[model samples]
Target: MEPTPRPLSPHLGIYRWQVQMVTSILHRLTGIALVFGSLMVLAGLFALAMGETSYTAFQHFSASPLGLILLVGWTWSLVFHACNGLRHLLQAAGVGFATVVFIRNSWLVIFVSLVLTILIWAWVIFGGAL
Candidate 1:
């Protein structure tokens, strides 16, 4: 008879959260969000092609307060994913993976993501883009 397999070791729930972990989790989450967001975009395009009334209705819903909040959240999610993606790309390319480099780059990703989100929204609000 074959011996029984051993149990798996501790995973995500067993450890305190860190920047690297946050980036890892959010990467997957943002990917899923992006898929749904793309579907929304396709739906809007279809609606636009249907008629002026459909397009106007889509626009009105998109301009609602809740819609605006979701837009901001999706924007930030995209920014976060993009920032961490660059970090991962650097590691994959044989750059910036030393202990100190990893630590510094992790913080850099977090900082730059925040800055990009703020700057984008600032432009939307004050630059007459919104």
Candidate 2:
């Protein structure tokens, strides 16, 4: 008898993008990004404490176009991670346990995260702290 050919498993293209899915994956990726971003923040603080030259170098690097782009990305990651973390905390507290409630809250988390990121960047661009 001939052996049967087995089918390949479904893949990324087979799956549609969903709010909950993106939020779940981004939560992890943002957590990792924040770890690295936090190091940059610490380096900036330490440089400022050291002297004017070191502080100026750090500030100059941060103000560059590439640096600004990275800063934007890292900022969004931090905001999203924070929002999703709160969602997880609420889940732990037994909020949004139902399927519909869970999905609604997942979207809510994503939307609020984006809004928070925008507000923060706006504040920074307008010369204020978030």
The best candidate in terms of TM-score: 1
Cα miss at 96, model 1 (Å)?
1.3
Score each candidate by Cα lDDT. Answer: 0.84, 0.87
Residues 13-87, model 2: lDDT tens digits: 878977677788899999998898999999999999999999999999999998898899998998889888988
Deviation of model 2 at 72, angstroms:
0.6
Instruction: Give the range of the ten consecutive residues with the poorest summed lDDT in model 2.
Output: 121-130
**Superposed model 2: Cα runs more than 4 Å off:** 1-17, 128-130
TM-score of each: 0.83, 0.81
Q: Which stretches of candidate 1 lie over 4 Å from their true place?
A: 1-9
In lDDT terms, how accurate is model 2? 0.87
